[model samples]
Target chain A: MFRSRTRFRAYSLAASCLLLGVSSSALAGDAPSTIDPLNSPSWQYVQARYFDGQKLIFDDRIKVLAPTAAEDPLDVPIMVTSDGIADVEEVVVIADLNPIQKILAYQPKRASPDISFRFKVEQSTPVRAAMRTKDGVWHLGGTWLSAAGGGCTTPSGGSSGLWQGHLGEVNARIWPREDKNQRLRLRVIHPMDTGLAKGVPVFYIDQITLRDDSGAELATLQPFEPISENPVLSFDLKNVGPVHVEGHDIQGNTFTATIQP
Target chain B: MRNGVIGLATFVSVAAGAGDDYHLQPVPVGDSAQVFVGKTEGFARGNGGNIVNTGFIVGTDGVIVIDSGPSRAYGEQQRAAIEKQTALPIRQVFITHAHPDHFLGDQAYSGIAISALPKTIAAIRDHGEALSDNLYRLLGGWMLGTRLVPPDHAAQPGTVIVAGRKLRLIAAQGHTDADLMIFDEATRTLFAGDLVFFQRAPTTPNANIEQWLSTLDTIDQLDFQYLVPGHGPIVQDHAAIAQTRDYLRWLSTTLHNAATRGWDIQEVMQTPIPERFRSLSVLDQEFPRSVTHLYPDIELNVLPKQTAAKHE
Candidate 1:
């Protein structure tokens, strides 16, 4: 059993026959959401690399929701929400087995712990979200997203100077929903190229900062190359009116946009 | 004699999987255009990649084949089926685009002048082998001995006289980089290959959403009564054009908004498809595919940008 467990989790999902042209909706009905004990073989490396060989506890406080299979490996959207985890300092997402792991590291200062964004996957693997509480405990949660594999190794369709004319353009919308909840969503036009594709450089958005009109920080996200091109990030805010989206690409070109409610 | 004939026929059927037969039937459109309506499904072994609409126009002097079909076998069988309808010699073949479904069968029309838009011809020349190999994988034995054949003649936009019939070749783009729509003036029939899909969801593997939407409007303005689509049913009214436009517009708008709203691929896929388009054949398969092909770019365009902080 341990030997079988050592194989890549995505390879196991691939063997389960997800690619015989079965419509994704059909496989979606089955729920395999909960798996225990940090089951992935890459967990050791991830723990040593990101968690510093520290003991991490599996907790329900951190939740991850993603599609069972990635239709387009370059843009697999995922949501990571924390429940009953108070004083959370930061959340780090990792896709075990991806050549380039550490999808993104998020610090939710003024926005809700709930966040949704897109990422790239090179293959089927365990995607985990670990939230560190103020007490220094790392709470982990994740799911297995099955894919035909090669979300990274494959050349990105949007990487061919596709963003040349409109590079650095930003479109944002901040609206208030009922019950006083304000939603913040925006997209930045940049290739976020993984440099995995031939003749392509490793350029991507290094960081994003959301702030209120007064220049007070809302939330900051550090996205890696696995983030899809033109990274679209969404967050729910407890505050209201005039949110500013700010960030820059790897080339040191910076940009800023403000959405008024 | 009947027993001997039956025995020979049985022998032919026994060679099944050797790319022997397409068993095509021509459905008459208006006065002279005969369309071979294909299955409302993607390429599969059961359909032998016969999921494309190929037809011919029978004129006073000769016949003009609209498209070549999917494989050499389909093209040969299409020719046989056309022969059963008229004695006119096959005069000209016009390809709509370079998509494998539209022109892979050109191998069978070797002697005839197979024509297409200049860009269409170049696309086939560049990607023909890869596309044909994919069909062989999808259809297995049905693709037996099939090879890619690019159109030899460059057909410009405007009227072309073929076999005594005046055809208005309308050049457009969107569904693919180069889409050629043929209008049979004599019959008031428009052979809109892949440009218009009726009762089936349009495939957008090579689409530019904004351009496609604009082209749909242009097609709606054309003067034609009968329409032959690349993959679905033939229609007399403008329902096909409407359905095609409605679906594409919704897809493009929804994808853009989804990206702007930071919705992921799964979220976009899970969003309920409007009930109006639920009945379209292959929507289930085509919807996801279009999203895969189009969503990333749509997202890239509308997704906000963070640029160099402005001075001052």
Candidate 2:
């Protein structure tokens, strides 16, 4: 449970920019990409693909808690959350050395900026969470997870039922703490295949939506092949109610479940 | 790491003349039994896959073998060693379970009556090759010429007289889907298979901790004066059985608690062992593996309900 964190900073940057006679009122700017502590070879490419000319900071405000070594790379659980960064707009999960770099992206509309999910690790890689705040700056937090590799390429034949016949089976539960903190955990049965194995094509859950009883969006997830087979995801919600989960795999199969908190 | 398939042909040629390289010395257990205890460690080129115990019992008519060793070399030498003891023909060979250490040696005993529980046979048929390839990666030349050979017959659980010796075969699960424990009524000896590991961490890749614990109680009740674990030294009393049970209980509880707290695998693996379990051979190496095998389920089963259970 070793943690690395950075202090959320500089709301005064905007006020200070005015006195410095900057051209724009916006205070946020691209932090140096050289702050790569993990120093993954994929850093330059990852920055170009996701953050691309946007103001970014590879800071610790966005905290990513992951295992130091992936015991079962097929389902390595991770927790991503932010500290003082408020009004987050987007959260992107990535494993720099994995064959599939971008694992998933989450948009928590009415949910807290906290999520727990499992993902596949191809090898030793720096797993990261990039949170884009409302101020238009992308902040990244990452931890290194060493693996024996091949979690993505090898078809984990362990859960065949999740793929063959019951591709859309859903198991969901709403956990309501006495302190009014609500956590929703759901699992959708799918292979989440990366098309890396012989005779197996890319078949995976690509989009997931959590909505309230009135059908308003609670949060949305865009999952890639790096997600574990029979993907299970958990989220901390801003409010408690009956939540509906609807999911669609890349093969067009769908699954849905409703849970009361 | 290099792939194990390459240079395998060359390794096989070197192994033929080296069949007796295991130096398999069977120690006398009782009046009728000889146990070839293996090293209490992981599979490696130095040890081959000879990290598992195998033995044989001499009945009046013939010999009943407990298990085949890890490779063709171990199995071939094991039969040779038995041949040195008695002139009786080998009556039956029992594969304790489908784990590679217990069954991969079946090739050397071709034409012999090799038997196992139906599920064990199925598991060997299903995952045997993959498991063999795993050892090939570790031991390389030591695993030369080793091939997957599934059991020839399905063993029924009951009292059966093999080679004029009354044997009780108990079918159980927990260590794996199908584990067979053989009790020799004549000598009051029990071959516990991998179901019991004394002074060594239990492997849990195919274990259900709760079910395994329950099965241990069943084993404790067996009226055997001598116990032979699939690994580690033989015991005269229930000390080895109790050690295995105590270790498994602590392992399950630790993992359950860790998962309930949402601790990632590294945190769980880094957990310190108690003073009691420190005596277990290779606990540092094997404990991490057990955590890897069982922690995923712990997270799935405990993560959601535990918070509510603790705070409510």
Candidate 3:
């Protein structure tokens, strides 16, 4: 089993080299360059599948905050912030080696350039956040995080129906930022099981939609099982007046909440 | 020069917290033995779980250190502190268990013969990386350059002469599947390892309560003037063993009863702390974690019995 996995990884490496238009000899040379996300076949596939021919520029201005090693792989908190960039079109988060690599992509509507979210990390892998500017150039930033693995495969601690009573319970708080923007933080109770765990099957919240009091969709979120149990997300809200959140799980259970400021 | 600057910056970040600083001040136990009792603190980002107690016995020509602390820096400080009092070289380091706090520091004791049970060596080999990663997250920069060092010698259950002093290594299984208890024949001092935790609530994340209770009984039978536990203060009386035994019994009973009644884990966690255990260090923090670890097993055990009873 281990030998096959190693062989598969070697094949992927060779395939990645071929796809990135780089010779294998260049990869094995002295003074080898640092790992670039654009050179990764996974990132290339994400870009081709999501952005459709958009040019991505490596930018250090797009700051990302994540631990070099995660204590609990089930809930790895990450924050992505960009400065000196104008007219952001979308921000996409990719866990380069995850089974479902494209974790989240945010098309901000009247929101700030900063966002914080938590997701499950499968193993030691690179976590990338790419910001698409108004000119259609994708600026990418990422960091390598080391984990003990099995975050997605292991059974969640709440597997014994412990969360049944608290499912869909929502806690919403709004804090005013210094720049006159309000940060909307929402925590919903759900066990985002990844089905890889023994006997857990795939139970997770599949979608969440945020709307204003007038029923206008403010933003939509499509989350996967990799999101931590009792999912919490924070968004910088520009026009905040009695926001309502509606969500549905893979089991077809719908959850709704109202936040008044 | 740049590397030196980066190293200095890392050291400064790690040393910024006075509470997390690695300092071992040896206090005399019994007549000739000395012990360094670490603070009974919980695992945090700052402290890195440096809460286990370690001690040393000065023999005729050298010293035998019991249970290295939680990190490389801790073991280095411990070695320095031992050298401050005696000029004897550390001949052998005895690891009490496979827990990261007890064995991770083996990296600092370079060239010394580090010893542990065969199971402990296997555990260190299997789980050491995961444990190190966990410690890295907890200690951050404090765990700089710390790596897992496997034991060089197998500490079998027998007496071994170290520097003309007879040291008895006994295999005790309860607190962990394989625990080593060291006894100094010259001083009548027993290093009880994690088999005993005094004043502080004992952590049983990897314990078998019944086997641990039997091990406690075995420890009670040993002839010792002074007892050094894996955590908290030294023990002078046999009654101290009862504290850990009672807590284990209470925890097991609580978990079993809750499981039999089909109560939720949150409800079981809400089981009020006994008045006697309220003053134990880190009780509030560790009890819930212990419940989380042991309750699932209890539920599994009881669920099968319940089904059998219903069929009967």
Candidate 4:
């Protein structure tokens, strides 16, 4: 009886091995490692290398809201407000997975802790909103995104350099559908190539600076190679006046647009 | 030697002014064949010329093209440039792949024998019009838009066409579903389309990095002296092929490890291109994308199917 049991056990083990081999063979060519999305050193570097030892605090005082989807991921509308926390001092947003990580950082001069801005995302990734308090502690909140790929590598909109030729006609839109008194969103159509895209001899934004009717600085925006193709900046510019925004890229090309409030 | 130096000298100014952007230039690689390099538009993504070479086999009958330009505008320029070199009517056109830029110029060869991988021909026949229409909609506003032309003839693997000299088509599948590499045994030249990108970075969105590397291995073993890439300059040295092959191989191995760990695709997009593969030009611009596209394929552990499956 013992000998018979041993033989049966051995036979079943061999059968299971055979089945495993066949199943594995069937999936031989199909494997995740072949083309896994999140498995790049760059991806790891952004997470493991950049976010190390950094504190991303949670701030109930700040709230971020935007539409679920937009035509371009790079320039999505986002509104940041310090609804409860009067201690809020600054707001910074980082697209943890953008070719450029630091998306937008806003420093509020007035006590109005509320802010709005438009920023671009290359692909679907998580965006973190960190609010700094009077105590200098950073609070964090964000959303994960499945972004449109190929936009970063794909050609920009327009036929050649016509957009640059017409840079004077900068279009701007202010956001906050419900609470207009508190927040404002802005978007600019600049060919913010970030010096990485092809076709352009030099890659840089032609402009940056937002001012009031009297040419007073309301919010200042700077772009880096990490800024999405066309910058979609959302900021908290609120007042009863004419606002003019001017920007000059690294190449000394300048463009300005005025917003009537 | 002095003429070549003068030619190189003139090229530097143009290259410097163009900087990262490509300036259309002519590269004469063979006794009878010359390639017209295509520069991308100012806002477009590619920096290097989409190298489109129309070669003359110099046979008794007429001239045959290894591949045509990517668009109708490029096709006209290529044909005009060919006209300047030799007035031999373009008798046949061997398409390398079905990419809009690679075979969209078939309309230029109207009545010529438009040959490609059998599967590629079917793909072009099945989806060429829709793809062309989409491209026209997406990119047509520039440069008078693009024209669409379908293929006529289909060639399977191991197919040989012997006119004055023998030509063999090797169906290489790492770049696209059906990428054909034409071997000119007489000239020892390999007309490799997107399969090779020479100095420029290659697009690996639809590639199987492993298969691509193996195909390169197969190509290295073949006794070819010259390799004409789909994009970038002509590669006279056999070692140039290694540049592309090494990048793909290194990318596959490095990205695979990252995927095994739980890295986010978004995070990967923001990171810099791998330092190891920076030697290939366009790494900064192309690497993020290659990482994005290649990561998904590796994470999935299989190549994305050329055609999606139907489910009710």
Candidate 5:
């Protein structure tokens, strides 16, 4: 009996590690420094596949603020702020282990140096924000968040017709920033369902373009399924003007709204 | 790095005693009340987020358990502990709410009659599997062999005589859509489940703060000398209820203000927790969760009247 119990315990531990999808080495409590994104297999793949073998500098100047553990994996809030890094051109958000690892690639123009958004976290993984400065260097910072998994895989609790009447609806609000520049916040109603969710095939807004009333593209956002349901995006715009927001989902359903200054 | 080491240390310790390992220690709270004060801590694999307080009352004829606990193993251990104190059979198990920590342990008391409010029962039936899956991922080995077991008896808001003791079941909403507060007339002790969190931050993922605040007021007026909260230490006075009420009110107002100011969720997160709450355990963890749960509602409340009317 004792031997069988011991064997069962061993099997349980191994199965638990497999179920959690975390290697025993990762759970063995090594120093955080040892868990560098550059060394992680997913990050390495992302670097090579996305960055064309460019070197990423580990910089503390870029801060990624996320909860150590997500209370709601479906909408884990994340904030990325830079210490006024000069000539910062863009910020790329990545969930290293998500089925769709690339969440967003944001190009900030006259926007504040800080950006905050909510996204889905499939599991406990390292979330990183890589800031590309005008000098062509990628500064990377990240933190590990432990989650229960299934933000991407589980069927949402809402009824199937939840978005029938609300699809593509957009609400925009513009507020003055401290520097007198106006901040444009847009909220679009969409399921953003990842194909990974059981019983729910892939349905998501693929591309969003913010255009001036005169048809000039102000910004274009390529969002993946990992974007939270009812996607909300914020940008800092100088001298507000009437703008139009347009997007289409994977099913080719079109949505459009006009934002007036 | 420090946190990682600590986590590993806890895992090691838990693994060292893999068989028949149970950490709950029950202490007497009142003349007849005994509470198993769980580790006053946050969710971690080591503790399995079994941070809830489960209690029982031993009367003339039998014993009545307050909450079932977090897992099958926990419930089994709790049963064993209670047996050590009394010879009376566990007549019935009262589940305070539908949260996994409170009802998932029903499997351990298979032969015993398990009871909960109708809504709580429905919630457990509907969300139990999902909640168990989440807990299994979080607690790992501790949740091994745990399964969801729906309550067998539907408890209503009225007096039920168990073991010849008058037990008043009060229906409450806010902390959850269905929260039950059990008041024992015989002992003058109230088992305030998740409705009252003392010294620890209340988990608000399912809370309706407005309803919860009003529920607190109702609980405060109840006639009870001893109070057992779902997550924290036992209370002798009404101060604990006020503390919870204050926290909920402050949380609601803060979210409202942040929404009105058009603050991003990050800015709301950065808002300093009041000095009064700085001393509460798990504030760092539960505060952000509360914001995430309430911010969207707050934002909806602050939307331009015309825009909001249109969406509806």
Candidate 6:
């Protein structure tokens, strides 16, 4: 197989070289050369934000786990589990490279030891997983990447012009067998633009909140540059209740969905 | 030397932010071969042995250029250098692949026959503007120094351009679907782009390892004397191609096992690049991402929904 593949590729190379007879003069037109990054700004500070002079310490306890060291960095799998996370009431994932610093913020409703969800990393940077436990102690974990680059710069999603066409479609699927009530997964389709790119218009999601069918807020996530293009989130939901999530970006774009019980 | 962001800027940012021991050095190739901007030398050497250089082939009638530097502004700088070196006009720009750094400068060569693989042209048309837009938005004022140019002509198999010298666009898949290596029958020099990493782990996101490995075998059979990569200094030895082949062989095997074990993607992601591969450029960063890309290549039958979750 290897020998045949080699022979075939060689034949193709020779063929490609033969096709080099196009008019060289016809291919000489050059496009404009100046590029400006600030023409659009999607989010402010796009990556992580430091506050109150209390720098979030970097520890190895917090890490993002996912398949393929490289995926569309936007929706990379991330989980925050640590021995020190038991007392945490809220955690924020921030990406500092983007026009926006805050990616997603999770405010737990109950006392949970750890939190897991799938989030985006716009580029290869030090991702700060900052958690504030019930007692107000902030613990942070940091991980570095080299390849998941240009997250803020990579095109919005796999499909072109989908964000504009499906401006209001928010899809959520809870897995582990819907009745198993073991795991919950949710996805949102929004432009999630950082407003930094050129040509395309700017839009943002002002606010987004996930609630239970009984009108109780289960989780609230704020999207930012670190949140990837189309945001997919997953976590553990122990109780048997119809899950509902609502989100509204800075552009007044709103999305609401209910997971079948 | 106008506004230019070479590997140095990227390395400095990594060091100051992450506290890692990072170093970047510039390497010179040819007699006064430079990569535009302030990088007077021909190559920019990053930590872990990654190098990127820009060179032009001067023929009696015209010049055939390889990958342009980071941006259009930088490309203009490269053009200035080219003018200094050769009186012949740059009549053709042959892109070896579609990575932003490789093909973005097509705009600087006005009226030049820009050539690349068919997929490369499609990728540029598909994502070229978006890439420029993203750079502008993310880098802000810093992006002004860089420029991206979409290709004017697709270098499909059999598309030929006779400019004093015969230059062929070889169909070499693996580094990217748009991967192409420009072969000059005159010098027997192959501009392998990212397909042939000189001293680093060639990034394999859009890469087809199997096809890439096979391409290497084809390259070995070719009668080429010189080799240039998308992100490294020129290669005088054919063994560089073999080295890249060995690295991929290892990666293909290791990652295949991890995927089969149903290992957590992050666990596989966090697993450090073995000590052997660490010296390669972009290995630390590109390795994990390569894992995700490789999974799909090996587990061909598995559905995306079963193997992975949506990005959101």
In model 5, state the lDDT of residue B255.
88
lDDT of 3 by residue, B145-215 (tens): 77889888998799989867899999989888999999999889999999999889998868898999999
Q: How many residue pairs clash in each candidate?
A: 13, 0, 0, 45, 0, 72
* Candidate 3 docking quality: incorrect, acceptable, medium or high: incorrect
Better of 2 and 4 by DockQ: 2
lDDT by residue for model 1 (A88-204), tens: 778899999898998898888877777888888988899999988778878898888876456776666666666776666776666576677687777777788888877888888
Model 6 regions more than 4 Å off? A1-73, A84-116, A120-261, B1-51, B134-148, B156-161, B289-312
Q: lDDT (0-100) at residue A71 of candidate 2?
A: 57
Number of the top-ranking candidate, with lDDT as the measure: 2
Candidate 4 residue-wise lDDT at A195: 39
lDDT of 2 by residue, B1-312 (tens): 334363763565476445438888889887998899999987767787788999999999999998998888789989999999999999999999989999888887888899999999999999898788767765777677788899999999999999999999999999998999999998888999999998888888899989989999999899998899999989999898899999999999999997665455555777999999998887877887787788777767753321110100
Per-candidate interface DockQ score:
0.24, 0.09, 0.02, 0.02, 0.16, 0.07
Retained native contacts per candidate, as fractions?
0.41, 0.07, 0.00, 0.00, 0.17, 0.11
Best by TM-score: 5
Residue pairs in steric clash, candidate 3?
A: none
Tens-place lDDT per residue, model 5, B32-52, is: 779998766775676865788
What lDDT does the true structure give each of the candidates? 0.80, 0.81, 0.76, 0.57, 0.78, 0.57
Q: Which ten residues in a row have the lowest lDDT in candidate 2 chain B?
A: B303-312
Model 4 lDDT at residue A202: 38
- The true-versus-predicted C-alpha distance at residue A191 of model 4, in Å, is 34
> Model 4: how far is A176 from its true place, Å?
40
Model 5 residue A108 lDDT score: 62
Please report, as a residue range, the 10-residue window in candidate 5 chain B with the lowest summed lDDT. B303-312
